[model samples]
Target: MADDLKFSAPPVMRSHPVNPTEPIDTLPELLNHLHQAAYVEMSTIPMYLYAAFSIETRGYSQWDPGVGASRLIRSIVVEEMLHLTLVRNLLVALGDGADVTFYDDKFMPKYPSTMLHRSPPLLLHLGKCTPDQVRDVFMEFERPKPDPLDPPPPDGWYATVGEFYRAIEDGLRRLDQTMGAKLWAGNQPDLQYVAAYWNRDGGGKPLLVHDLQSALDALKTIVEQGEGLEPGEPTVPVDPVHPKAGLDELPHYTKFQRIAEGIEGIGTLHDFRTDPHAGDYAADAGLTALNTLFNAAYSYVMHMLDVIFRTSWKDLKPGESNFRYHLERSFISAMQGILVTLAETMAAVPAGPTFEYYALPEQGKQAHLIELCDKAMTYFPQLGGDNSVRWLLAKLPDV
Candidate 1:
């Protein structure tokens, strides 16, 4: 079980080395495929965060952190996260139990890498992404398909994340047909999840995937949001309950386009840097320190998720009352907000890497901190509402 989660998990973005001719037919291969799906989603988070965080907000008022560039890139990051959750849940529905791990030590992508090593032909840098980068490069990364309805590209290797998931979808269908109910032997609804954190970040409810239809919804949510297009379908996929944003009718690629092109009512035009900011992180002392803190915080978030999965799958426990269950979710929610702020802070501090994921050497210490916070929650009510997160933040070198 630990081996499955690892997925060669440590040096960052491990390769599956698939055999081109054969489909992902067996259970083990399916698990490996899901693990790769997790990697695909994991690969994007920091890259988009770095770009969004690097936007120049010198004279922006409506959107303080950023208006055009920041909003576009960050929104994609959120959806990428949604994509990751969907895949992890799918893994549990098929197998791996409810405690399946979502990520592992080598979860982070290197400073310069590619999505599935094919989505973008160019090497993606973890630096300040400029308007030109967004228009010329970033937009292309999530660029719409030449034909939205085009069939999945030839198997073996995928040129885009969509094509990759399309292949996975094909595998899911074939296996379901051959194995029938056996394919979803361990389907667990309790483990399923859908993230509706923001007004615009809606659609695709969490599902129990025991059958074909349910599985399709799960897969479709990932693909459609990533680059799905349905005529007469609103692009943003809003959760009617929270409609603060004017229109939620665009996919990730289109959202980036709005920033690259500009929304008439929102703001004025800007130029893509001819000589974009490489964000030479080593040059700045303070920014480097904050980035390190951000990386640690990011790893802790991963650790919390790891605990939640191992507790459920390995130890046979899963519930809101479970410390791992509660803290993992709470920490993620807290960290999401913090990430937005942290990304903004990185943007403010010029010439710095946004954050990078490294293996947390003292995971035991992290676990201890979670335990300490849990103890504080039970015995010491005066600590504050978010003692764990607050304590984690306090660990940074200085304010």
Candidate 2:
């Protein structure tokens, strides 16, 4: 069934052109930009996660750079997730739902590709955690928009991720001031996923954005955590979540810089190939099965998110479980547990899992992914012996 499934590209979400130089004047334009923001945030996850998974922390001490590096990168990935969720919430607050486009050909970028709306295109790669990669791809992605006084990009596009988001922030404020309550006329409060469902210990909690103030707060957390304050600026005091964890409170750019500058050490890294593709292992059944399982699990998580964002929340009766919570648990477990394990295994194979689109027939319905999991167990018995993955898939929402 998995093999017979065809890859389908999702319908394009952008109905209007995005010109950063012009102010967003209409609700449709703003919604399109919000969709782009969600895409940018979602696109970085696999690139960062692949590197984090490649860092072999087995023999490294807690104080070693390798151990610290993995923890640091993983934490950034966590914050990125928060950023994505906040953007989704913002969309929900504004009457539009955010789409998870990672599993579609039209939406998901082929690695070594630039992010949406980024001019002078920064090519992101999926590879091992080498210093060169840290210095180049990761750092560049989080780089601050140089020269605060300079005008916006002449091409009407952004040069940095920070700049792209700054445009969105400016547009949101402008719209709120002008449109007033009518802007949120289609707002669905129940569709907004709140902080209670997110990781508080991660970068920051997911914020609920109903009004202008709350929306601004969400954007503030994203920008501050990503770019930090520019040089020569007074540092804002952060209430550290883990004071002893060292660098946990620092912005992502700072953390990546430290590792790139050799200020922090990293343990042994697997020789995983760069920008791997699913077709790279098509000749080997075992590797193919592993890759399929990994991609299927990934698609499943994203589909669950689409459901969460579009579907309204409802109360449950006695003996009935909340599918939303189940979906959330499945997402956390699949990313941290299943995906991580598969990544490490692929690294050991020296091939690496391709973060490509994998479609399952009638996706988001639960049964198809469970079937894929069963086949994966047949191919790789140690993937939580009998029914482990099946149990996980069973709990996912069927929307």
Candidate 3:
């Protein structure tokens, strides 16, 4: 029997954009930014999960036009949840408890009016605007074209939110440089607080962002580690907190393994863990590899903020060309990429006991959801030809 599914748009809300540059000198200011970022992360979790649930509700049996697309989206949703967790953890670490009891949607930042401008020749590339409305949202946060003569900023220095951290980093660097070795001895509360975690582990290995060289070296190390290449193959036994071990221990792996095993032709997803035939590249080093990719990506993001704000803070006014939108958009897109890849990879692999029953009736519904994803993709070009969303969508295998 054929199933008929109809498409409907998700709910939209209007609110003011959270301006992070509003001169936050007090703890309240920092807390506000932390809260706002956390809220955004929290809101995204549901959006991704709902997209995934829509697919799960519809069974895998029939060839609904967009079933594959929905499945990919479901994967993206899960990763978004992980990002939310990451941000929440960061907030808690900063002494801001998980208190969203008073968080109103109206308080959430709105899209900038400047972003809505139709005057300029909008460049729609990765993270740029496109035709599809759904896709447009994904592409809206792309980086602007850099001036040729100035030479683009370094990898960590971004033109947007990247500036914020850059400012903080600059202050630390200045203090260290001017005060000599005694800078670390200062009693300033905020400095002390940031210094406390300067060498802390972010789940796997300890991350040290005290200097530019250290930051660069960390990125290189993460990339290398993801490829399963440790320098010198030290005689040390595997530490429980090692990136590889930590990733392997994630709960999602069990589910991924199950899905991989159930697929038709692919063997157990675990096979990728040891198979020499698996691609020899760093990015393809399986789950650990994916973790490394995310970490590197995040490092770049952090670095960019450090540089941008360090250079621009003195001249810029509050709420004028704020980078919050760009930051949020970058996070959303990167997270989406991670989740979709994880799920799709798992589904593509084959291994375990196959279920005898399939949800035939849900196939039509799943297809309908996939179609919505496709329509969303079309909206990307309309948003100024930004291909970022399209790039994200392309990562999924053709539906």
Candidate 4:
């Protein structure tokens, strides 16, 4: 039977435009910006994960710079999650439901892609970002600010992530003058993440926009964590999650630079790339089965998130909440497992090939979260083999 699916209009996720200098004036514009914010927050996580994971698993925590490089890349990926949550919190406050599975083409990263269509654009790829790639591409993407000559639209729109949110902050303040507290209509205080979401990840609260002050704080948190307090300067704080992380960790941009510097200091180049290939594990490579399974597993994650987001936690019965939470844990765990599967395939496959990450049409789009999971469950045997059996066992509810 043909799969039945009809998706809502994918959320607006555009971040740049010809008139980037145009300040946001209305609610639609603000929502559009928040949608863009969600995409921007999401786009970087996979890239960093790809790199952090591609390092020989054994080499992780082995060599000084290698270990440091891997740790830094991964830590930044976690913070990006905080940023995503903050964006979603803002969206819900603005009266929109957030969707993780909405993999629309807009803001969908293309390798050799510039984030905001800036001049001398930082060409990005979805593979291992090494020394050269880190400096030329990743650093450029997270640069403290954009160049003045390229265009001010970028300055207002394409510049540092901080500046982008600054624009959003400005919009919120402007809109507040007219809307007042009515502006936080979509706000859901209950959905806001505490330290628990991170598995005791020790970060501060997700951005909750109940008023101008909270909105600005949320934006400020995103900027300070990623871009730092000053332009083009380094600020290393202890990993807030760590017990002894006192002034030891740096922001994403700085972390990339540290890897680059570490590589050079060790008398070799970290060289992330000339163009992005999914390193060796690319699903686009000849590894069809592995690729399919990887995508399936990843798609399941989106489904799990959709469940949590669509329904309030408090509304769930104990059994349902427990089931949902454990399902989430399984899906999250499967993410790394899928990556490992691809890595194994990469090793076995011949040289000069790439594997692309893809979730099929049957996997469903943004709205079909539950239906998709049910369908995906049937394919567990082929998609996950023995592991699927374990997930199946854990998922059973006591009648």
Candidate 5:
């Protein structure tokens, strides 16, 4: 039944809004909660990417982009992506197939927005990598729990994201006991995103969520990685040379805190416009074209992800051999090579990359992406050097 659903299905109407403090007794409520988790993970990526991209890298070595801050923030972005993938697989395993329709207005968060249902809301902004932004927004997103001596948050809100996931974990255990085998009947292990397909080095390997324990393991990764450590876990010394070195590596919150407190040097950063949008550059042809190409490549990455999760193993025909693997490789290439380089180029122009909601057209999507590249090249000739654009585009799936 999920297969019959459109790749870009209209957003699902939930029975209730995602309020983490409330009970998730029913299957639908749990599914909706997981969807919100996915959104939370997805929403943070662009915000973090914006800050990472805004760092000025003119004097920095190519190997070390934007000095330590940029590298640190980008590393965290990769983990957030890992978090997103984990949440998506959890949803798919629970039978609510992947919904990568990021183009929809409802799914994408507006600039200067508060996170979904968070209490005492903190406004999220997309801008340069400043100490204030790092402390106020980035660190706050993953702020550790209050001192146990302090009072808990109001009844309907969670103190931290870790508390929220713990609640989800409790709900999953309850539902598993109540529903038994039927709860996991919809799980399709083959459809999960596992380590074999992910080529990147940082951010722990993708965990395949099949059963209840595996599901909880995935959630643990999300919480622990986001908020520095688990309760009672000693703080690991920051590895300046290799921050994301291992499982005990410094958590995201710590990384940002270091930069915010000047414990870590971020160097100079460009003051690009906050909350940039594709429409913001309408008067500037070059920016508009570059933004268009960047967005197309960005959207195509999401499309490829959707295709990977929804596709079946049996569908790999002669021409489609290792299609999923190719998609995985291309997705990484697009992010690291195409999107990263382009965003930096835009930053050098004193413009920020706008992560707007743009979907590739239903048909000939790959060809359209190539066309966008050519159009963008007219303004940003740096994009086509060494035929990297076409090389990356050639691996893109048409779907």
Candidate 6:
């Protein structure tokens, strides 16, 4: 059982590698990607929390399909929290601040109806539902696709989340070749350093800056230099491609605009891959496969949240005032439920022969959770409501 699994405090920091010297021809585009990455990370927290709440309050004893799902979900949630922090730190390093304000209920990221094609009907109806109902809606949000290679349209782009990362990697390489030294000479210390790290790691070897041991050292450089921490440092020196040595740079776009662009780019990338006839713009090559992997992983996490939210809300009768306190509270509860479900799912991995068929190892599970968390946290602060309110809501009673 996942309950028997030990819980431990997550590491305070981790290393990420990037190439600082590489020049981005489209600084706005690159920044847009970063913003989208951050937004996804931020969006995941509420779902994880809701899952944890459902498994604990609703009682996992009722479900016999899996054992470690809840524990895995918990671990993933914590990691998602970590990812959010990491992305925020990166954004800060890049001279950006995420907006963490709540808006009207209508403002939530609308799950495209097309994305829910294969999803259970119970998971699809979340229009103005109660807190529990909202949580249930998320239960299917994170369910793994049986064949991630063939993702549904609108949402399924590339092949996996790993493929998405690959696109970022490719973009960084292009930026390096195109922008060169001009990219590194920027006053945006964080962006410069990240470029450097990306340049060094483009070859695919794990860079020192990305290793756990070197995280603090890299962070110190980022902080002292007023740059965001690069996940990894680049090994190769950047080539000077710009003819003009010290061009006065234009003032970059506002933080909000940067974020919006980043999110849009990600969406665009997804559209490119999922649309069979996207043609030249389609993510047929380069980092499209990585983007697909990223989407799959992201979808899996959301599916878990949907399950917990639906189950929990359905258990509660209609007309409950619990829905009126604060919509953010509901978001938090749903998040806890997601966490619990993750933990339980992971715990159950070793219990059946199905595990062999899937070939999902324990370490892979941890890494997947961590990756998902990192991806989701980037947009958490941009969410509505005070950080305290968000935190308190996440810590609410599971039921």
Cand. 3 TM to true fold: 0.30
Put the candidates in TM-score order, highest first. Answer: 5, 2, 4, 1, 6, 3
The segments of candidate 6 whose C-alpha lies over 4 angstroms from its true place after superposition are: 1-25, 57-67, 93-156, 184-399
Q: Write the per-residue lDDT of candidate 4 for residues 217-264, one digit (tens) a residue.
A: 777767767776677556634333222544544666776777777642
TM-scores of the models, in the order given: 0.72, 0.86, 0.30, 0.73, 0.87, 0.33
Candidate 5 C-alpha lDDT tens digits along 57-175: 63343454324776778778888888888888888788887544444556665576666544445667897888999998888888777546546566656657777777789889999
Clashes of 3: 44
Q: How accurate is candidate 2 locally (lDDT)?
A: 0.71
Question: Where is model 4 more than 4 Å wrong at Cα?
Answer: 1-19, 57-66, 98-108, 117-120, 147-157, 191-196, 199-208, 236-248, 263-286, 318-324, 337-399
Q: Give the TM-score of candidate 2.
A: 0.86
lDDT of 4 at 252: 66
Candidate 3 C-alpha lDDT tens digits along 249-360: 2122222222333331111112221111113233433433333232233233333222322222224467675343343344345444533333333323321111011111
Number of the top TM-score candidate: 5
Please provide, for model 2 over 1-399, each residue's C-alpha lDDT reduced to its tens digit, 9 standing for 90 to 100.
111111221223333245555878778778888877777787788898888777876445475534467777877888889888889899889988643343565555457665555544566789788899998888878877654654554555676777777777888888988999998887788877773455443567777788888888888878777877564332322422212333336677777887787666667887778998888788988888888888877776776677667555565567988766666666777676667777776677766778877767774446766667667667666665544555655655565
Expressed as tens digits, the lDDT of each residue in 1-399 for candidate 6 is: 111111210111011112222433375555544545444444444433333333322333225432233333444444444444344343333334322211112112222122111222222221221233323333233322223444342332322232333344455557656766544332233211121111121111111232222323332321211111121221111111211444221111111122223321111110111111113213333222223222333333333322222232223356665332333344444443443333233223211000001112334443553344433334233222344322432443332
Model 5 CA deviation exceeding 4 Å by range: 1-16, 19-21, 58-67, 98-103, 147-152, 196-201, 231-247, 317-320
Position 1, candidate 5: lDDT: 18
Whole-structure CA lDDT of model 3: 0.30
After TM-score superposition, what is the CA distance of residue 254 in candidate 5 from its true location, in Å? Answer: 0.6
Preferred candidate (lDDT higher): 2 or 4: 2
lDDT of 1: 0.56
lDDT tens string, model 1, 355-376? 5554555536455434444443
